[model samples]
Target: MVSFIPSKQLTNPQTVLPEQLVEALAHETPLAFQNVEPFRRKSALADGSQKFLLRNQEGKPVAVAHWASPYAPHSVREAIARVNSAKQAVGASLAPHILGPVGHGNVQGSSFGVFQYQYPLSENKFFWPVQRAQITPHLLQFLQEVARVTQVPVPTSEIETKFAAPLQHLSLMEEVPGEIRTAAAQALCRLERGLWAPRYVLMHGDFWKGNVLLTQKQPPEPKFVLIDWAGSKVQGYAIFDLIRMAASFKVKPKRLGENVAAHCQILGCDIRDAKSYLLAAGGHFALNLGCFPLERFVCMMQASVKDLDKALAATEVN
Candidate 1:
């Protein structure tokens, strides 16, 4: 049976929960460890979900609890689905183990809550790279593994729904620039005819160094665990994830086209169609990741698309 945390009002400075609620969460949740205290809290500004880090009697970090209000049932359901999909795509070891909406009886009356074991402190602090240049080949390989596992064949008939809709929606958004819309329309034209990539893969939606947790126990071949899967998708443009990883790591706009070309190779898509992939990824970002109103995403697209030809052409050099 699954349990849930009761709906409670969060006070000011969203990250800091009320002391009384903290005490209740520590003892009432299913994985309720004894003598536990919350050391940190973060409230997702965009989604209103609350996160708490709890430690046990020995003063070692033990678990994390994530809570959402009953009013945001979609958020709770989506989070649960995304986490399960990630585990299936990347294996249980590479994904956090999510436990119940753990609570006492009256599950229907409670709000949504989930708990997960905390990764090792050292791994959290030092395992993942701090800079784009510091990203290791093994880490890249791990990302590839995630992409590889989630690939699914897309039938020609379903192309419009799966690949073209997002780009179409992006093209129609007034917030997007004219040239970007033109680029999206061109990509949509090809995708509508079933002419671009042949398969769709699950996208992490926000794949970045910060979202990845690395375990260095194996030395030189560290394993990774992904978290915060609230926005993950079972079938989306895979290149979006790759480009997001690069862009989030602060890769320059001009260099992003090159990264897109490389990611095409990784995903078994045609390298010659890298431009189409970039537009599709941009569309996904705008439509799916709530980047339509974000100027940074727009500027990045404008700059990258402006230099894309030169960048990709340069890559063709010996």
Candidate 2:
């Protein structure tokens, strides 16, 4: 059981419950132990997901924990247990820290705990669909879940928008380096200008290499796990997950077909339609790039433009 201090909404700086999960930590760790500092919100989730720096009584930060809504039939606690258990057989070395059922159960009713590895100071860019199979079983399970959820066709007009844009635009943050910036700018122009119609599919909205953790479970062979499973909605474009994966180098770009094929195999879908999915993935990748300061996304976008050079050059005006 993860230890947690009681939350007092009426306190000085009220510690409100994260919207997703409403359970509290199992024990009372010192409030000072949690290292609550400048944090990078992992993807994003429905309204109230609270991410915190776990600390001991001495105010020493112990771990980073996120309190979110229960995804599976189990509570956050069960989910974390499952993820940890699987680490022995599946995840290998990389263990993503899942924390909490959070506060008291709200409408959905759950108060479990989950855990994962500590968040690194920096993150990488890029990734693809069904790519985490090699690393973490937890990730592969997530891939399967995506297919199962999206199996029911989504109405063209009504995909829910869960990921929120920055409260304030960041055109001011330092721009990405030149080549990366230009490349990304070009791709954005094409996407915005409709150089190609994106073939959309359901997405793990926050798709990229940064979200994937590679564990050196054994010699030569490594296992991969995708974390930050929030805003993971279905009925979005399929490519959103794919293009980012490919560009991130988490998976081979040339093997986008193989990547989607693996998922199709698991879900029993036709692989012939994957290229269109790749196109759609490109669109999602563009949105992810624009999510932060230009630098986070610019290089990956530039890398993608290089891959599409001939095509971009050929799209001449009639």
Candidate 3:
């Protein structure tokens, strides 16, 4: 029997940054030093990684800074390494320039890591082109290059273990109706069975439109820059990244299959084999939904389940 924990206690508490930390950031970086007010933005994680838009003396946004609560030194290290690796693999023009660590100190009894940041073009109202003709080739190039540097052999056991978390969660969720739970379980089982013969590559674990930044509105060449490397993994399914990216832009599932086909052609994967990867990727999102705070939990959960159902039907996976 799976015992339920209260959702409120399971959620990570929000951490407010001190004026001292903001002042310390200005001193550490090449920004106009002052008691400038920082604008807060919503972060993907609830782990108190506070993202703030720091403005200069003229009140122009200069840089963004992410201050991590609970002091994840390893995460900080990985972020630096991944950013540098990606920069080398792609180029400085297409990757966020990490300005290095800023400051680390205690905030509200929790230790934190203050890190420098980059101003992405997306912040200035830039978005990717909706047309596949313009979007596909550039995205493909970026994904291929990123995979080239970061690919590593991962054990099948590790992949299976990672995929199982969601299934376990769904089995224990009393709130899920019986039919939905049964269908989801069956889909997960099919996915697990299908993924036994796996292919691995380095993945921008959370690859989506939001993390991709465009440098120009009009193009002779549209410069694409990737940001937020903390969630990256060396041995990950490439198809997972592709699926997430398509979903991020609200591409229809049928259209997503077309995108998937193009991705497979570039990476040399059989299109027929993409189903398991898609389902497994959906499972990851579905399982993680409950872990998020209540505000985003239901909406994200519904979207994930919808994606799973679409993929299952599109692929005709029993």
Candidate 4:
């Protein structure tokens, strides 16, 4: 447990951490900064929140903190939800241990939280798409563990609302290509008929390489820690996570389909049809990833549809 002291020199205008956030951290968490300056990172988007890497007096990295803008209550809410969702899934074994919220002042203005981990995240080397053949199996194992803990029976109405409705909406969008829209329409019809609606598992929702942190630990010891659980769901299509991971590699569409197929086998999911997997994965992403702009979402959906088409065509050729 580290003791914190808010230094006057560290409270200047150019400081990345807000004064309120600093106070919250001093009072709420056991992080010590004192004369140490935090390494700050602004959000890639205009989300008006910033992340800070706090260090101890000895210059050892200790905790990560997030400070949200006054207007971004949703960001704060998502932060809280992310912690709760991770805890509900299987506690700190699969994620960074939650240090709890800095203060309950999210709605009033800014919000803050801190997370501490023993091993530093492998920030640089985890993403090696060229070696996907070796990396994908570990990712599949992580996904299977997540599903094993979080799987539950989802009702049809929930499926329609969560997946089919978003797909129907996408199908009507003019910005989306005809092929993608047609595929979306077909997927919606299948949902209505109860196809691709069963065997729901908790989806990481954004299971890309960036969100996955590999510790410097050797193989046989636990190394993977999944972060950013804002989009996790108790009842979701596991194919969504599988496809998202494949897409992050920027693999060709047919290759992505093959990866998902192989991953599905590992998870014991029976989704073999390329079109069926595409529909379910696409619909799940379209519905839950509201952080993406409509245009961006449409573009992703178009690309995904094309990839799945290639995958299906390749399957037919074989």
lDDT of 2 by residue, 268-291 (tens): 434432333333343344446533
TM-score, per-candidate, Cα-based? 0.71, 0.41, 0.62, 0.74
Off by over 4 Å in 4: 1-20, 35-47, 90-108, 117-135, 217-222, 250-259, 262-291, 307-318
**How do the residues 46-102 of candidate 1 rate in per-residue lDDT, one tens digit apiece?**
465445555555555456665565456456556766677667766665444222234
Each model's lDDT comes to 0.57, 0.40, 0.52, 0.58
* Quality of model 4 by C-alpha lDDT: 0.58
lDDT of 3 by residue, 1-318 (tens): 111111112122443456555555544555443223343443455444555555555555555655554555345445756656655544454444223345544444444444433433333334434333466566755565555544444466765565555555554555655644564466456546763344566667666655654544555665555667766655555576766666765556665655566555555545544554544454555565545554454344456456645754675542
**Positional deviation of 123 in candidate 1, in angstroms?**
14
lDDT accuracy of residue 111 in candidate 4: 68
> Best by TM-score, which number?
4
Rank candidates by lDDT, best first: 4, 1, 3, 2
Q: TM-score for candidate 2, please give it.
A: 0.41
Sort every candidate by TM-score, greatest first.
4, 1, 3, 2
- Separately for all candidates shown, the number of backbone clashes (residues 3 or more apart, or on different chains) is 1, 48, 0, 0
Please say which candidate is ahead in TM-score: 2 or 3. Answer: 3
